[model samples]
Structure formats: structure tokens, C-alpha cells
Target chain A: MESLVNPYVSVDCVLLGFDGEQLNALVVRQSGNNGEDVAGIYKLPGSLINLDENLDEAAQRVLKQFTGLSQVNMLQFKAFGGPDRLKNPEDSVWLVRFYNLNHHIDRIVTIGYTTLLRIDRKMRKLEGGYEAQWMPISELPRLAFDHSAIVDEALKAVRAKATLDVTLLFDLLPNKFTAAQLRNVMEVVLGITLDVKNFHKKLAQMPYVVPLEEKEDGVNHRAARYYKFKKLKNKHI
Target chain B: MESLVNPYVSVDCVLLGFDGEQLNALVVRQSGNNGEDVAGIYKLPGSLINLDENLDEAAQRVLKQFTGLSQVNMLQFKAFGGPDRLKNPEDSVWLVRFYNLNHHIDRIVTIGYTTLLRIDRKMRKLEGGYEAQWMPISELPRLAFDHSAIVDEALKAVRAKATLDVTLLFDLLPNKFTAAQLRNVMEVVLGITLDVKNFHKKLAQMPYVVPLEEKEDGVNHRAARYYKFKKLKNKHI
Candidate 1:
């Protein structure tokens, strides 16, 4: 054997967007790549790291390409660099196509990152690529590589994190929103019906929920005052 | 390039043991022909999988190697096959160590699985070249490749699971252990002081804990009756 070929590591971003009634996962179209029979089938926003950049930075760059938003929070959840998770040649899993791997083994690697974003059409103008669409979380399409698996893992993480952290809920709610709309979003993400009284009782305990000057308008019932959560950097128990 | 070499997926086990107070990570001294200096230091217990082996089965096989105890509960927390998380002579972090890796990278592709195990010295003793030892979880020595980081990630996972699942706690406790002993182990693993009363209350709610007639003889304070956990398959929730 002459020399072992370096394995490839790519970054995949599983961006989740939550609306008031349902949850959606962000997927992108793969086009103009190494092999491209499949054009616009949805997949997690992903790309190979450029020669000059680091891994986390590479993921951020990929997301920015899709959303035109940079410096958003992200993390590496799992690395899927399987030699054969990509057995089908025509599939996106075929990213494992490494040259000179025959001379020696090439173990392909890709890090999976999950991000929760409050994205609106106002976020960015689409160019060259198709616009990002929010698909129902449960109804995900046949994704490329182990992306379905990645999506599954990201959902588990989101559910676990949402249970303990209200900070993510804050991210989803807008500047001024009705409590009913807020509860609807929370219920959708949590996948359970929460008692209004119990939820209000729990929310009352948190001092961070500052009562805003704003109030709901044109409601059939009595108008409710809108409250905003004061950002707590080091939120401790 | 010829047909791309199929990528292989393997699971590495980072079995952790919490003997009363401090935590220790299980590591094996590998005796193979990859890197010579790696023989003495710690790397996770791992193995390459059979072509037909599913991810979980491969991980279980790797975990049981040290213990000889089959059906040892295990978890695949994260996949860590970074094509170049390995040092390669091609292009890289291993630019200095590149030549060394050029000679190496093809040996194996390892995914890490972290498990909390009941420590038994007999299980740790390997017949051949591999030396299995329980080293302090905090002060683990330099491990082979990124095995050290894999172990750390496993620790985080083991801790997280311990909090959410009672089954993980059973792995830490003795067959018949006092309530205080169980709570102590939980605190050590979690690095938190859980409310003792609430912890026991939750334990009482769990169906698995079978109360034993045994009690600690030497204890000066209130002696708590020992309870052993009934194992369940994937019912950690």
C-alpha cells in the first residue's frame, strides 16, 4: 500500500422551524453536484467543508448559504462516516465515493448538527437554489444518506431540551403574541395537551415573564395582556 | 478511480463504573499493529462489525468482550466515524503525523457506545494482550486517536441517561443496595445533589425495585432496606 487516502467529513444541519400549530424540518435540494439525477428531493441543509474552514464553521456556512443568516447557534450531534451506510451508488449516501480507497480503506465521516430557528420569509431572499419550505415534522420525505436517522435524533434532542428549557419557547414566540397562540406552539412541539390553569400556574413562578404594555385586540373574550420573557443569560435553577 | 470502497461502521464501547464515590471509565490497552505507542494507554472497548450486524448488536458484542456477561444493556449515543477524525497523511490535522496515519487509517472504523456497568474485577481481566482497567473518569490518560473525546461524550450521555432512566441507575448500584447508597451513586454520576426524599419517592413509583430483606449491619444511622432492580428491555423511560 502506498499511502492511505484521507476520509471525507461533511457537515449536515438539521434546522427545525416551529409555527403556532405544527412543527417543520428544513430540507434543501441537491443539484449540480458530483452525480445529480435527483434534483429537488428534500434533505437536511448540508455541504462539504471547504479546504480552509473548520467543522462547526463549515456547518454554519452551509446554513448561511440556505438562510443567508450567519453566526446562528449550532452543534455536532453525531458523526455518520460509514463506509457502507451509503451502499446504493445512485443515492446521496454515495457521498462515500472516495478516490484511491481501493488502495486502502477510506472511512467517510460527516457530523450532524441540529438548530432551532424562528425563521420567516423576511429572513432572506432566495437565489440560485429553491426556497426553504417548512414540512410537517412527522411527514419527512425519504432523505439522503442517514439523514432520516439524523432527523430522528434531532427530534429526540428537541423534545428532551424543550421539557426543561423555556428559552427555546421564547425563540419561537414573536415580539407580541397572544397567550393562546403561544400555548398552541408549545403544545405542537411538545405533542401533548397541557392544562391551561396548570401551565399558567407554572409560568407565573418564573419571574422573567415581564408584563408588556401590549395587549391582544379584537378577541371574542376579554383581551389578555402580552408578556415577554426577559432574556436570562445564565439562567440558573 | 475504481468503484469506491464501501465504508464500514463499527461501535466502540466506553463502559463506565461508579464505585461508591468517584467515577471510573473502562479502557483497554490494545495489542494491534496500528500505532505502537497506543498499546499501553486507554482506548474504548471496540470491534468491527459483521456485514449483517445491525448497529445495536455490534455495540452489544463490543460491550460484552470485557465483562463476559452477555446481554449487558448498552446504548449507541453518537456515531464518531470522522473520515479524518483519524490522522491521515493525505491532507490534514495529521499533516505532521500524516505519514504515520497514511500507514494507519484503514485499520478500522469505530462508533462509540457508552454504558454504565456494575464493576467486577474478574470481568476486567482479559486473557490476552488487551488490558482492561477502570481509570478515574476525570483524569483519563491520553487515549488512542479520538477515543478520549469519544469517552468524554459517552460520559455526558451516561450522565444524562442516569438522570432520566432508573435502569441506568441499576447498573451503578449493587445487586441489593440501600436507598442512601443508590442516591449516593446517583449524585456521583450526575454531579448533583438530588433531593433525597423526592428521589426515593420517584423510586417507589418505579415498579422494578424489589425490596430485599437485607440491611447494612455496620451503619450507625437508620439502616435502609436493600432493593434490587428488575431489568426491563428498553423501558428506561
Candidate 2:
């Protein structure tokens, strides 16, 4: 099928995943004009929206095409479309060659979407021409095309939502996760080392977090009690 | 200067204003193809984005042109870019004439921005060719161009933020507002009547809400004490 390029609209995905200990993001390594790998250059998975496609479909296509993952819940956070969003010389070079963006079509506005995943649960592998990696969000390199700012905004959205809704934490943990693992995801996303007493105190108040009968298995340390999020029927909060 | 219209890009504003007793929205009356005023047809303020303009600049221009207001803090919340967004017969008839959209450039994607304002405090008036009104959100008409859905999402964003931050209430109320006025705004926005005892109990716990040594004057009913939001200088929520 011919690519129905609109040149003015695109979608970018910030996939924040967790591996039990740290927060990570799925980023694709952008290559230079010579098809040579550029060291330390990564970007959030993105693509130009097709003329006939919806924005959400475009976002899902970008996620699946880059990370080989599907059926993930994504939330649209913000739109980043400053005129100078592509003024970086390297970004211009990459887009002009790879995306067929000419001078007149360089000022594209991109919609940003975010998703949190349990990377250790699925263990999905990347399978595309673009080399994708799960890099720690804390140690992120300078990204291309205003993506670092996009990631910052996505992180803010995640942190803000995580505070009110315990169900969102389930996206970053296994079916049965330790309280420490849940607290670690919150702390890492909120960028704060929460007090041990205060953290458990807050969790105890949440009726949605149900303690399972089973505990952590086969770990070197003491087995911690596991908990899972229970959806409250007909409750809107 | 020319329009510089990028047919595939546009800006839509969901300007939610509070009018003391109720939450309201600024809506423009959309016209018919023959330059006749379309009865009962309203839309959120919107315009085609200029090719040389940033998304934020485009949104500000649209808001200013429609409402004669500027310098308000606005947030880009979502992007709506369905292929058939403008496929409705009435929407197409209006846009094809006003926007010069042809067959090749019919699918326009719009970035939705939201801003909450104190209508009584500013008293800003609409000054444009199209008639605009501050309609109560509870009695909103069926809006054009997927705007009702956008307004719903904006309300959700405002309500979600309001629960965590008392400072957001200041946008809807005057500097020295009575507790009744404050609770009315919250009740209207959240679409639920908060219990008087429970609401004040929650407010008492919020250190940010400082009770002032003043009372509401020139009212038919009994005078009520006034309060204002006091941000902690070195504290984080």
C-alpha cells in the first residue's frame, strides 16, 4: 500500500516499562544518513500518521512495529508541535532521508502517548530494522526531535495518575507483586524515596490492594507477602 | 499576510470558565454555508493552524480571536485526528466554505487545549464576528466537531487536578471567596454534591486553605467567612 503521508501530523509513544527494580523506556536507535549506527542516539518510537488513519491507531502501529508488542493500554498525554521542534540539524537530516520530510513539510506536530508495562512479565523482544532497547529512564541519553521533553511530560502524567489510582501500579508489576516492588515503582516514577512506615501506612488505607495468600518464591532474601489489585465493581474514582 | 493554512493541522480550545455559582464554557455559534446563523449549533473556539506558527501560538491566537482574552495559562490535553472527524454533513458544509478544504486535504487533525478561568474576576467579553456565550456546562448543547467529547475530557482533567491541589480552585473563585462559593465550584465540576460536613472536614485538613479574617458582604443570605489558597513556600504535596 502506498504510504498516505500527511506531513503535518504524527504520533510518538513513550513506553515506560518496569523490570522489578528500575524504570525503563523503550527507545529506538536512529541511524545516520550513511546507514551507520549512531552511538548513544535514541528516540521514542514514533511515525508519521497516515492520511486515512486515526491518531490512536497510528500510536498502536508505532508501538507494535518498533517493540513487537500489542494490546497494551495507552493514554494520550500531550501534543508537541513547536515550529522549531525539528530545528536540530541531526534531526532534520534523519527525517529528511528516512521520513521523506522536505523543507515545506518539516514543521510536523506530533501527539504523544504513554504506556506502562511489566517488562519482566511479557519479555517481548524487538524485531524491526530500527534497533530498539529498553534503557533505564534515569540514565537516558539526549534524545532526538523534542523527545526528551516528551518523555518528561509523560513521566509527569504517570506520576500524577499513579498517586490517585492504585490500579495503574498493576501495569508495572506482575500479577502477584511484593509491596516493596509496588513502592519501588511509585518511588522511581515519583522520583522520591518514600518512607517505609509512611508507604505501608498509605497502602493499608487502599482497599483495592488485596493481600494474596502466596508469597515471593525462590528468592535469596526473606519471602515477602504478595498483593494484587482488585477492581472495585461499579466504583468510579 | 495570507492564511498560511496547513489543512491537516488545527487547534481547538476548551475554555472552561467559572461564574461563581456554576461552571461554564465559552462556545461560538457556528454559521451555515449561506452565511446564515445556524440556530442551536455551537462549537468550541477553533481555527486552522498556520504553517509558520507553533501549536501553542496557534492555540493562543484562536482563543484570543474568539474570546478577546490573553495571558491565561492553557494546557494541551489531547489530539483528535480521526479520518472521518469532519465527515458529518453539517461539519463538512461549514468547513469546506470557511477553511477552503478540498478533497485532497479533508482529514484535519486538531490539538485540544484546555484553560480554566474565573469569569467574574476577569469580566472579559467576547469580541468577534461570531456570537459567543458563557453557557452553563450542565446545559451544554450538542456541540460541533467532536467538541462535546473534548469538553468531557477537559472536565475530567480539571476535576482530577482539583482534588490533589487546592490552588487550582483559585482559578475558578475570587481571591477572597466564601466557602460556599468554593464548594459550589467543586460540586458543579465534579458533578456530585459534596457533603457539607465531609467537605469542610477535608478542607480543614488541607493546610493550603487559609481562613481569612473577612466575610462575604452585600448578600441576601447570612454572611459567610472568606478563605484563600496559601501555597507553602518550601513544601511539596
Q: Could you tell me how far off, in angstroms, the CA of residue B130 lies in candidate 1 after the best superposition?
A: 1.2
What DockQ, between 0 and 1, does each candidate earn? 0.18, 0.35
lDDT of 1 by residue, A59-156 (tens): 87888888887877775666665456555444433342322122333334567788776655553334235545667787888876678888888777
Candidate 2 clashes between residue pairs 3 or more apart in a chain or in different chains: none
Q: Is model 2 an incorrect, acceptable, medium or high docking prediction?
A: acceptable
Which runs of model 2 end up more than 4 angstroms from their true locations? A1-7, A32-40, A100-104, A121-124, A127-129, A196-206, A210-218, A231-237, B1-7, B32-40, B100-104, B121-124, B127-129, B197-206, B210-218, B229-237
Estimate, for each residue in A28-101, the C-alpha lDDT of model 2 and write its tens digit: 88875566665458888898787657889888888788766776778898888877887877777776566543
Candidates' C-alpha lDDT: 0.65, 0.77
What TM-score, computed on C-alpha atoms, does each candidate reach? 0.77, 0.85
Model 2 lDDT per residue over B1-237, tens place: 021223367889988888887788999888754557754599998877776678888888987887677867787878888877887777877776665445545677888888887886344455346677888898999999798998998888877776776567677778788778878887887667778868778779878788999987997899888998886652211
Clashes of 2: 0
